[model samples]
Target: MSPQVALRKAFSAFPTGVVAVCALVDERPVGMAVNSFTSISLDPPLVAVSVARTSSTWPTLATRGRLGMSVLGSEHEVLCRRLSARAVDRFEDAQWHATDDGAVLIDDAALWLECEVRSTFDGGDHEIVLMEVHEAETFPDVTPLVFHQSQFRELHADR
Candidate 1:
């Protein structure tokens, strides 16, 4: 197998939670579906998300650092899938609230984080974005949404 194949296989072994980072660009809300998001440092309230260099949304995201990160709930699979597609109106049926900067706070997310870009590192295939968490809040009821092996899956406790 080639490097790409091997990399994909290895990455697939690790499950991750899903999130959508949405921000305002030209007075419009743009959202990117991401799985490569994590908490990097707790002391400084920092988080990170990787974005592909070739992504069409990269240019717009690069122009702004203040963004909203919405952690999807287990019931949000349809919304997640809609945002991942290249189709029109990613937010057509979805309900969202506007932030001060005009980005969206997705309805019914498990958590919503408002952040500012702290720095970025050029990773080979993706740009690693380090964000400073300015503010954050969690929904009253939250069951996490997870992704594994290029498919949506959730965890359950075994007795």
Candidate 2:
């Protein structure tokens, strides 16, 4: 296998939680499903998600003043795939509500975060977007979606 493909295979061994990094651009919902979402700090309430430089949605979302992050639940496998596709209306059949500031939050997510763009940095082929949380909510009963080996999965209790 090629070195790049080998590296991708290695990376796929690691599991990650899925998140939808979305925003209201021109009063329309726009977003992409990302597995690279992580908390950067607690004191200042910061979070980060990596977006590919070539993503068509990121450029539009970056221009928005605020963004809504939805931590995808196990029930969101189909939604995640729809959001990640190219040239499709991601929210055409999705149920979501928008904040007054134009942040769109998906229904039934494990967590929701209303954020403002704090900063952005170069991360080779991707851009690391740092966001400062202004408000947040969590659904304790929901199970988060997991991505591993390039496939979506659900967590099972240790037996």
Candidate 3:
């Protein structure tokens, strides 16, 4: 296998949750899929989501100032896939609400974060977006969508 294939295979074993990083540009929604999200700090309520520099959405979102991060629930695999596509009407047939900061908060998302873009840095093939949370909303019933081995999955705890 090629190095590219091997690299993908290696990382595929690491399960990750799907999230939509959305922002408003000229009153329009611009967002993308990210599995590279993590909590960096609790004291300041900070988070980080990395996006590919090549992603067209990055240019619009990074410059928009304010943004939202929505964690997709298990049944939202279709939404996750929709947002990841190259060119499509992402908001089509999707239900969402707007945040004060101008982020289009998707309905039924596991968690929604209204954040301000704090910083951006080059991360090889991606650009890391470090955001400061200004407000947050979370759901109580939805389970997060997980990605593993290049596929979507759900986990069951053995208790």
- Report lDDT (CA) for all predictions: 0.85, 0.92, 0.85
Best by TM-score: 2
lDDT of 1 at 156: 76
Q: What does the lDDT come to for candidate 2?
A: 0.92
Stretches off by above 4 angstroms in model 3 are 157-159
> 1-159 in candidate 2: lDDT tens per residue?
999999999999999999998888877889889999899999999999989999988888898888899999999998999999998888877989999999999999999999999999999999999999999999989999999999999998899
Q: Model 3 scores what on Cα lDDT?
A: 0.85
CA lDDT of 148 in candidate 2? 99
Write the candidate numbers in order of decreasing TM-score.
2, 3, 1
Query: Which 10-residue window in model 3 sums to the lowest lDDT?
Result: 92-101
What pairs collide in candidate 3?
none
lDDT by residue for model 1 (14-113), tens? 9998998888877888887899999999889999999988788767866776788899888778888877888678777887876886556788888999
TM agreement with the true structure for every prediction: 0.91, 0.96, 0.93
RMSD of 1: 1.6
Residue 19, candidate 3: C-alpha displacement in angstroms:
0.7
C-alpha RMSD of candidate 3: 1.4
Model 2: CA > 4 A from native: none
